[model samples]
Target: MTAASTGDLLTTPDDLFWQEHSESITESDEELLRIVGSADLPALLAALAAATADTSFLSGDLRPPLTPVDTVGHPHGGMTPLQQERGRKVAFAALKRLRDEGITRARMLSEAETDTILEYLGNGHTEWAGMLRHELDLAPDKNGAPDWRFEDVAAGRDFTALIVGSGVAGLAAAHRFRQAGVPFAIIEATDRLGGTWQKNRYPGVRLDTPTFGYTYSFAQRTDWPQQFAEGHEIREYLETVAERSGVASLIEYGSALISAEWDGDAGAWSVTTETAAGTRQVRQFNAVITATGQLDIPNIPDFPGQASFTGTAVHSQEWDERTDWQGKRVAVIGTGASAYQIVPAICAGVERMVVFQRSAPWMLPAPAYHKPMTEVFSWLSRKVPHYAQWYRLWVTVLGIPGRFHTVRAEKDWPGAPLSVSPRNQQVRDELTRILGEQFSGHPELLKHAVPDYPPGAKRMLRDNGVWAKALTSKNVTLETSPIREITPTGIVTADGTHHEVDVIVYATGFRPSEYLEGIEIKGKEGIEIHDAWDGDARAYNGVTVPGFPNFFMVYGPNVGGVVAGSLHFMLERAGEYALKAIREVLERGIKAVDVRPEALDRFVEWVDTENRQMAWGQPYVRTWYQNSRGRVSQIWPFTNVEYWEATESLDPEDYDFLA
Candidate 1:
C-alpha cells in the first residue's frame, strides 16, 4: 500500500548538466539577451558545475527575485529587461548546484530552502509552499501525480472502476488508475477526447489560460509556439497524452453511458452504454466515475421565429467548417468568450459583422495574449527541465484566488453594486482605463463596450486590442439592443430595426449548471439522480453524494472556481479523492463508500455562505456561474490549495461504507 521514497530527484550528473545546457544557452539565447552568452554567460555557466559543488550555491540573495503577479513564465520572474537578467541569474544558480563535491548526488533542498524557492514562484504567498511543492511538482523527477494507487494482486481484476467520458477528467482518472495498476475502462460518448477543444472548431478558438499553466503537471510540453495554445493543438495534446500514457487502449470509443443502476446485494452497478453504432452493452463496475464535464451541453436560446430565419444558424459548439464565410454578413449573438474570439476572426472576411451584446464582458489587459513563444525561451525549456516548471509556476499565480486578489470581497464597501471592494474598484478602474484606451478612436462604440458590472462579476475576456479594432472596423456594427426576434431575412432589435445578415453565429456559452444531463443515474430505491435533487445539484467535496454509493463525479456542482487554470488541477484533486475512496473500499472489502447526507449538507452550506461573498454571488449579477435556481453552482469559494488539502484524504466520518 505504501511505496518507498525516491531520493533527491533535483540533483543531476555533475559535469553533464553544465556541459549540455551551457552549449544550448550560449547558442540559443543570443537572439534575446545578447549581453550574456558572447562574453559573460558561457564562461560563468562552464564553471558552474565545479563552483556549485559546495551545495551552498542555493543560498541567496544569490539571484534576482521574481516579479509579483507574472503572466508569462519567465525563468526567474517578470518579463522586464531587468527581470530577464534576474531569471538568467536564477537559472545559472540552479544549474550551478546540480552536483555536490563533484559527486553525482546532492542533498535535497531543506524545507526552508524549498519554501524560499516556492515563495518566489507563488507570487510571495505565505502558505503556498506546501501546496505548490506538491501541486506544481516543480522538481525534475517529481510529477506530483496522485500516488494512492492499489498495487495488490486483485487490484486490476477484482477491484475495477468505470470512467465515463474521455475528457481531461476521465484521462486523469484513467492515467492515475493505470499508475495504480488497476483495471478500468473509459467510455467516451464521442469518438474523440479533449471535450470542448475537440468540439469547438471555430476560427480563433484558443485557451485563455497561458499554455505553461494550462498544461497537465505530469506531461509538460516544452516547445509550444504560442503562450495561449490554440484549440487543435490542445486537442492533439490530449490525444498524445491518452496514447503516450497508455490510456487510449483502455477506452471504448463512441460508447456512451446510458444508465447506471446500483444493486445493493451485488455491491456493483449495472451500467448500460449505447455506442455510436446503435449497439447497447450492459456491464457491472464496483465504482463509476463520471468525467462527462458540466459544459457538455450547449445553451442555445430559442428566439421567436428562430427556425424561420432561413440563414445558416450555428452554435459555437456546432461550428461548420464547410460554411462559406466570404463576404457574408454574420450576426453573432452573446458577447462572451466565444463571441470575443469569433468576432475578430471573421470580421475581415465578412461583408459586415453585427455583434449583438447582452452584457459587456470586462476585458483583462493581456498584451501577450496572441504573442508567440520566443526562440530563446523555447530552447531554454528543452535544455533545462526545471525552467519549464518554474515558468509554469510563475504564470500559475493568476489562477489562484489569494494570488489574484480581485475576487476577494469587503463588507459593506463604498463601491457596492458597481464593485465589491476597494481593490475590486481599483481593478475595475484599470480595466476601464484599458477599455477606454482601446476604444479611444471609436468613442461612439465606447457606450456599448465598457462593462457596467464589477470586475470578477462574470467571465473576464482577454484583450490585445483586437476586439476594439474588430468592432470599430467599417464593416462591423456593435449593437447593444436586445434581440427582439428572428425574421426570414435577418434579426430585429428591440428598437424595431431589422438588420440583415447572411449567417447567424450563436456564441452563447455552455449550460454549466446542468450536471450530467444525458446520463440516467438510478441509485438506491430507483431514485434518479436528477429527480433526487429536483433543480439543485450538490455533491460532497464535489465528488460523492448520499444514496449514490460508489459513484464519483469530476466537474461536480460548486467545484468550479474563478481561479481554476485549465481546470486540470481541480479535476485531478477530485479524481484523486474518488480513487482514494475506492482504494479504501476495495482494500477493506466493502461494497461502496457513500457520502453522509450530513456531510453533504454541511459542505453545501459552507459553499453557499462563501459564494455569497463572491462577486458572482451578488443578486444583481447574472452569470453562467448560477443555475436555474439562482444558486452559484459553478464556483468553489476558496483557494486551489484549500480544495487540494480537503481532497487529500478520505475522511471516514464524512462517508458511509456499505457492507
Candidate 2:
C-alpha cells in the first residue's frame, strides 16, 4: 500500500508490526510516519513477539521455523510469508506498485519514529567509529592529559632504561620508551610474554572488567567476542598490542631481573638478570620501571601438614587442568572472588564439594552475570549510530558511582564485623534481601550465605545465583571451622574432625604485600628495594621512590583500587608521570632524579589517612590489601578522578634532580 493510504493500516496493530519488523526500513518511511503519530496495533504485537522470541533464545529454547502463511491477492494483501521470503523481490515490487498507483501516500511523523531512527543511525556510526579507531591504533581518552613538562637536561652521550617483568605493564613501559625514541629492553623472570594473563589459564578464567576499559588507552579492540573477555582473549590482546606496537622485539622473555643497584659514581643503575641459559648478566641503565603487578605469587595458607595432603592439590592460579575432578570429592579453601567463580563452575561435576570459608565475601547482584546479548540488541549496537555508546555510558555510570556506595563506612551500625555504619548496613541488608529472595524457602541457608564484614572491607563478589544454588545443592557442604591440619586422606579441623576429599583447590589469594620479593633491587648507596621499605613498599604517587633515583613503578604498592574503578586508569596515570619524568631527565641531562624524602613521606601519610577512612583499613577486615605492619598497602585511597588529577602534573619540586 502507498504511504498515504497506509494510515488506516498504520492505526491497526498489523501496520506497527510491519514497520518494526522491517530491518531495511529507512528513517523516511511514511507508514512508519503514521505509526509514529499513533499507536499501531500490528507493530505492538510484532514487538511483543520479537521480545518473546528474544527471551526464548536467551533461555536456550528452540526457535520455530518460518512457514509460509496464505494471503489474499490484493496489492499488500497477497504478500504471503513465502512471497516475502523470495529475497526481497516480491516486497520491493509490491512497494513500487503501491507508490506508482498512489494507493498509499499518508505520512504521519512521530517522535518515537525519529528516536528509533536516530538510535539506529547512532549505533551504525559508533561501529564505524570503533572500526576507524582500531585501524588507527587510537584508544579513547579516559582522562585528560597531565599538567607536566619535561625540564631541560644536560646533554648526555648515553641514555638507557631497565624494565622489570615482561608483562603487560612492563611491555607497555617498553613501548612508551620506544615511542619516545629511548633505548630499553624488558627482563622477565618467566620465559613467556603474557604475565598473569599468560600464567592463569584455568577454565572460565576471564577478566571481570569490560574489554574496552581493560585495554591500554592507546590500543582499542572493536571485535571482542564477549563483553568480559576470557583470560585467553586478554592474553592474546596483550600479545597483539605488543606485536603491533613493535615492543615485542625489545623484550627478553627469559631474562629475569635479579637485582638492580644504582652506581652513584656512574650516575646509572646496575641491573642483574638471570637468563634461562643459567647465565647472569649485569647491565647499566639510566632508569628502571618495575611493572610487576601485585597478583603474581599465590598465597597458600599454612595449615599443619599441608604438604602431607595425599590428594592432588593446586592453587587457582596454577590450576591443573590435566587432572579430572569428575565425581571426585573436592575441597576448596577460601571463598574469595576466584573461589566464588570456580566453586559454582566445578560444583556440577564433583560428587561432593566441600568449601572451607575463612571469611565470606560481600556479594553484589549481577543481573546480566551469565546472560548473553540478545540478537536484536547486538544488531542494534552494530547497525545504529551512538546507540551502543549511550548504552555503555549508562553501564559505566552504574559501575562508577552506584558501586562506590558499598565501600563507604556506616557508623553506629547494628551489625558488628559485617557493617561499619548504617548506610553500610543498608547495603548489607539489601544484599541479604537479594540472597533471601534467591533462597526463598531456605532461611537456614541465608545465615551461612550472608557475610558479616562491611561490603567494601573485602573485594565485593558479583553473584548470579550460581553460588547460592551450588551452596543449597545436596552435593555441597560449607565448612567454617578452623582447619588444624591436612591429613593424608583429607582435612582435619580444630575439633579433631576430618573431611575427606579427593582434590584440593586453594582459592587463597595472592601475596600482594610482598612486592618484588625474590627480585633484589639495589638502589643508590647499595640500598636494595626490599631493604628500603623492609617489606613495607611505599612510593611517592606509587611511582617514584626516594633512594631509587629515576625509577618508576606501575600498578605498584597502594595503587590498586578496591572500589569498582578501572586499574587501567591508574596505570595510565603512572605511565604519564613516568614519561614526563623520563623526558625531564633527558632534557636536563640529569644523572638521577629521586623523589624527595618529604614528598614520599607526605604521600604515604596522605594514603594512610585516606585508607583509614575506608573499610579496607578496618582492624577486623583481614585481606591481602594489608601488609605485615597491618597497613593498607595494596589499595589507593583516592577516587579515580583524584589520581588522574594528581598524576596529571609531575611537580619538579617533589624530586631531587642531579646532573
Candidate 3:
C-alpha cells in the first residue's frame, strides 16, 4: 500500500491519526496474526505483556495514565509478585478489550485515553508512543514539515549535495534528498555499493545486532533471510533498499572524494575526487555530506617485523575472496569483534588457527546468532503490519536502558576497579559465569577469556556458543601473551614461543576516532578540519562543525553509540539533521550556514562532561572511542532519544546564516 498523504498526517493530531488508521490496522491484523503464529487471545496477550515488561530505561516523562502502576493500581515500583500478577492481568484484559472492540475510532482519543494506550503498549516509557508513531510513519517530517509538500516546495531550490560513500548512511542521506526533491549524487569509493560489507568478505562475517534493528527504520525489511544476517545478505538487502527507495541510480560507483574545500567567494564546496579509471574530477556542490563511515580505514597495527613475515598476510577488511583457506595454518591476530566471527568460521577448515588477543572482549549469549528465520516466520514478518516494528522495537529496547545503567560509573561503588558500578559488576559476573561454563574443561582458556575491564568498556561479542566452541577446538589456540615480533614463518611471543602459521589474518578493527581519514576537508577561511581538531574530531551534534559551512558528516564524532542502539538509527538521525540544515540554507536563500563556533564549543564541552561518566571515558578502560590524546572522539554517551531531540530542529541562534 502507498503511504497516506503527508498533508493528512502533518495537520492531524497524533491521537487523531491513530484513531483514523483503525481500518489500516484492521487490514493488517490478519497478517499480524500470521506473523504472531496464533490467534489465541491469551498467547497474544502474554506476548504483549512480555514485550512491555522487557522494555526498561523508561524516560519517566510519560503522561500520568502512562506512568507505571503497582499491582494495587497505585503508581510506583517494587510491587510484590501477586501485585505484579494483578497488574499483568489488568493490562491483558485491557489489551483483549482493545483487540475485540475492532479499534474503530469515531474521533481522536482524549489526552487521558492516549496516555492509557501508550501505557499499555509503551510500558510506561514516554518515548515509546513517539517511536510507535515513527514506526507507523505517522510522525511529521523533519522540523514538523510534511514529507510530500516539503519535496514539492524544495523542488525549486537550486542547491545540490554531494554525498560521499554509498553505504547505509549515504543511502539514507540520498533518500532524504530525494524525498525533499533536492539534487544530489552519491560517490562510492569501491566498485560496489555496500561500504564495510563490500570490503570485508571474510568467512562467517555476520552482524552482531539483530537484523530488524540493524536495518533502516524507514526501509524496514521483514524477510531478512537470517535473524542476524551475514555481511553479503545485508549488502544485498542494502542494494535492494536503495533501489526501492529510488536512490540506486543516483550513486556513482568507483569514485572516491580526495578533498573538499569550501570556497568563501563561491559559497560552495569544491570537492576533488578520483575515479577508478585513474582520472581525477573536480565537482562543486552547495552542500557536501561526508558519509564515509568509521569503518573505512582498517587499522592494521605495526607489529614488529610484520612486513618481513614470509606468509600470506591480510587485514580482515581486505580478506582475499579467492584465496583457498583450506589446509592453511591461519594466525589471526586481535580478538575483537571481527576476530570473534572470523575464528569461528575459519577454524573448521584451517589446519591450525592461532587467535592473538590483546584483551578479551565481553561475550554475551545470543542464541539467535547464526539462526535463520523459518519460511513462515519470514513471510509473516514481510506481510504483517506492525509485526516487524514491534519485534524490532523489543529487540532494540532490550540492549538499552538496562545496559546503559551498567556502563555509567557509580561513585565509590564496590568492584569499581574491575567494573564501573555494581550493575556493571553484575554483568561481569553473569558473563564470567557463562565463560566459566563454556570453558569449564579448560581452565587456562577460561582465565584468558574473562576480560579484566568492565562489560561495556569494549564491544560485547555476541556468543552463540560458536565463539566458545571455536576457541576450544583441537586445532585452535587462544594466545593472550604480548607479541614480541612477527618472524618469517610465525608469530613470536614475549615468552619466546614462536607460533608458526601459513597465513596471518589481522582481524584488527578500523580507525573509528579518525574521521574522514584520507580526505582533507578545508572549511571556511582555509581552515583544514583535520588540523582544527588536531587528531581529535569534534562536531556540533555530531553533524556540523564550526568552520564548515554546509559541510556535514553522517557517522561523525560523538555519534557512535557503541554501548547502545543500532548505528543505522543514529545515521538516519544525523542524516536528517544535515538535510534539515541544507533545507534551511536553501529556503533562506543563504550563501552558506556555518555553525557558530561558540555553539560548537559549548556542545563539545557538554559532550565531554557527559562522556566522562560513561564506561568508555573511564581512565581504567581503553577503546577505539578515544583518540591518541585520550579525548573521546567517538561514541555519543547518552540515550538515543537525547540525540534525536537535539537533532530534531536546527537552532537558528547556533548558526550564522549568510545571505
Largest TM-score belongs to which candidate?
1
**For candidate 2, what is the total of clashing residue pairs?**
44
TM-score, per-candidate, Cα-based = 0.88, 0.76, 0.84
- Per-candidate Cα lDDT values, in order, are 0.73, 0.64, 0.71
Which pairs, if any, clash in model 3?
none
lDDT by residue (tens digit), candidate 2, 305-419 = 8888888999999997797899999999998878887888889899999999887777766555555544444443332222233333323222232245556555545676777
Off by over 4 Å in 2: 1-156, 374-377, 384-402, 410-416
What TM-score, to 2 decimals, does candidate 2 have? 0.76
Model 2, C-alpha of 183: deviation from truth (Å): 1.4
- As for model 2, its CA RMSD to the true structure in angstroms is 13.2
In model 3, the Cα lDDT at residue 53 comes to 30
lDDT of candidate 3 over 540-611, digit per residue (tens): 999999888999889999888776666777888888888788778767777888999899889999999988
Among these predictions, the greatest lDDT belongs to 1
TM-score of 3: 0.84
TM-score-better candidate, 2 vs 3: 3
